[model samples]
Target: MEARTGREKQVYKKGSIRQVAGCVPVNKTTKKILLITRRKKKGGWMLPKGGWENDESEQEAAIRETYEEAGARGKVTSLIGVWDHNVINKKTGLPKATFSFFEMEVEKLEEKWPEMDERDRQWFAYEDALKVLIKPFMREVVEKCSLAPSNKRSKKEFSESNINKNLKDTWNLKFSAIVVFFAFLIWYLIKDNKFISILT
Candidate 1:
């Protein structure tokens, strides 16, 4: 499944195996989180997500799914967390399967609707979205968003450590240079005097 503009296209074959998906919510300037309603589905007010295709990786699948469901385009900023849960088909009473969830940042929002399969789409505040989502794990994703940093700190910390190491190296080099200069001066002075040189 994929979405462009506000329309969603679903190309997957029916009764396929379980697949991965992304639950993406965008925070607009007004602090509203966009939610997409699945057409004809009971629990529609949810994040955009879909299954992993044959050639696409999990992250790629997430990107495709988010657009397909929400009609919002964005980049996968960070992986907040993953969850494994059973989805029972309401009509068949059979276990649907497991799904992998990812949190993403919507890069673009268009007022024009895309030609897609989703029923409706709208934006709401984080608190309002929490009330509408049907699954408990979906809510957990929102909570995790609050804790996860906007920019990942691990990479920044690693770079800082490298800089510190480099500075320490430079300091050691300067200290060694000073010691060598003093030693050379002492040796030269001892040799300058003929008496001291002969005594050595």
Candidate 2:
């Protein structure tokens, strides 16, 4: 998965405020992500997300939406990030709606769930999930958090760890190449020495 800074490129400052919580439910054991499709909408796929009432916390809202939309529940590993986009509210005015995303480790996939008739849920491989997602930022968030859910690390921490690991691997590769080059050089010197070959 690629790394992204998730810039707020389309945030609206005026009109009513809307808050939504979304979850990228993952199963590290199977390395799959849960995606949902609207009953009437075709082709496009999405993570479990919905607006929350004032009484619910962001985390609670996310979990609830996951169950209602995806029919799975588990621990929230991290607050992935927030994305804002400009949209027209009911009053026909522009508003910046915030979508707060989180990574959830799915513990179970129930046989029955709310909105089962209105939504279709399925597990998808990381790559396939990216292709089905309709929103670009949503895909970015998923890719950023697509690290194994068991790691339960924040996106920033995970990215830094990956950077360090990649750097170490690159250094080791370079060192190995140099060692192989020197070994071949020494072998060639001995093999091509006429006097040394005659003595052996």
Off by over 4 Å in 2: 1-15, 86-94, 148-200
Q: Across residues 1-200, which tens digit of lDDT does each residue of candidate 2 receive?
A: 11112323222234356677889999989888999997554667988887755566888889988888778979999999988764646575555578889999999888887778777888899888989998888888887785634344676788999999999999999999999999987788777895487668
Q: How do the predictions measure up, each by TM-score?
A: 0.56, 0.64
Tell me the tens digit of each residue's lDDT in model 1 across 28-94.
Answer: 4566677777665445587777666666777887877666666677777667676655666777565
Worst 10 residues of 1 by lDDT: 4-13
Q: What is the number of backbone collisions in each predicted candidate, taken in the order shown?
A: 7, 0
- What root-mean-square deviation over C-alphas does model 2 reach? 12.0
lDDT of each: 0.66, 0.79
Return the lDDT, model 1, position 53.
Answer: 65
Model 2, TM vs. native: 0.64
Off by over 4 Å in 1: 1-17, 41-44, 87-96, 111-117, 147-200
Model 1 Cα shift for residue 192 (angstroms): 24
Best by lDDT: 2
